[model samples]
Target: MSDRAEKQTGGLAAVAGAAKQAPGRGLPPVHLWHPEHCGDIDIIIRADGVWMHEGSPIGRAELVRLFSTVLRKDPDGYHLVTPVEKLKIKVEDLPFRAVTLERDDGRLRFTTDVGDTVEAGADHPIVVETDPVTGEPAPRLHVRGDLWARIVRSLFYELVETATVEGGRLVVRSDGEFFALGPVGAGVE
Candidate 1:
């Protein structure tokens, strides 16, 4: 197929079609996250109409279409998580890193500057949290500083930390007896 005539179909559509007919490269679930040295990133791409993570079950038809985009062109339609409109990260740990990723099977490949190459189940869930909620019109998120990556990271950490905590004083102690320390005016004789 020549470029001139191939332009008739949209670039993505054309590629998706081609991949459907090609052999298997073993489509892996694309994982995106921030690096440990940097901030946290817990974002989910809802715009793609489909929410499939690493190891997610997909019919061959869907896999072909997705692979076509990756095989044909750069990752533009890939689903990535973010906080509201900006990337989120904790401010206290400013000037850090954001590890974004894309994965398949149990293997993962780093897509950004901050992260590591490791194996993670494809079904790993990223809890999407929003302050203003998804409805109405308010931006559904929170972040530190003005960086989009910061926002993304912060939101991710916040979600994970909160989920791990059962009651919620802050830290999730493994065994310590959480004794109440005296305050400034508690009067400890």
Candidate 2:
């Protein structure tokens, strides 16, 4: 490997080791870490939520989770911040994908690809937007802080299955809150 490649690997390894030592009590305080910008890394989160590094898929789920812990979205763009360095990463769409969902009582719980679980409620609301050009539905859920997870196609279908019309809007109730999926005429009425 080149010297730069080696440095990147060593830096990532150090971060992973530190993450392993820390208690698995929620996400790390990445917002507080003001490390020096180390420029952009060859990391890309594809639209489908696959994490790619150096034009290859990052095969280790643990590493991805570790990286996700440090992810931050600044006014400029998305970045992965460690104590020592902050590396920018590209995201074609949202950084996470809510691949699995479970209905808990009147609430809905979502599990992201990176293993973060979020419940839809006041703190975490589900929002659906229509693509102005393509007219396709783009559904997303707030995971934590400013991070969000895009609801996958299958999970969105499941959510639609339980949808109801309220106030002329297609809506679903989760966490005792009613979330409008779309207008009643969007085929959900």
Q: lDDT of all the models against the reference?
A: 0.26, 0.85
Residues 83-160, candidate 1, lDDT per residue (tens digit)?
Answer: 111122112221212244343443322221222122222232121222344322111111111211222344334323
**What TM-score should be assigned to candidate 2?**
0.92
lDDT of 1 at 26: 45
Q: After aligning candidate 1 to the native by TM-score, how far in Å is the CA of 76 from where it should be?
A: 8.1
Tens digits of lDDT, candidate 2, 82-133: 7787878899999999999988788899999999989999899999998677
Off by over 4 Å in 1: 1-13, 28-127, 131-189
Best by TM-score: 2
RMSD of each: 15.6, 1.7
- What's the distance in Å from true for residue 171, model 2? 0.6
* lDDT for model 2: 0.85
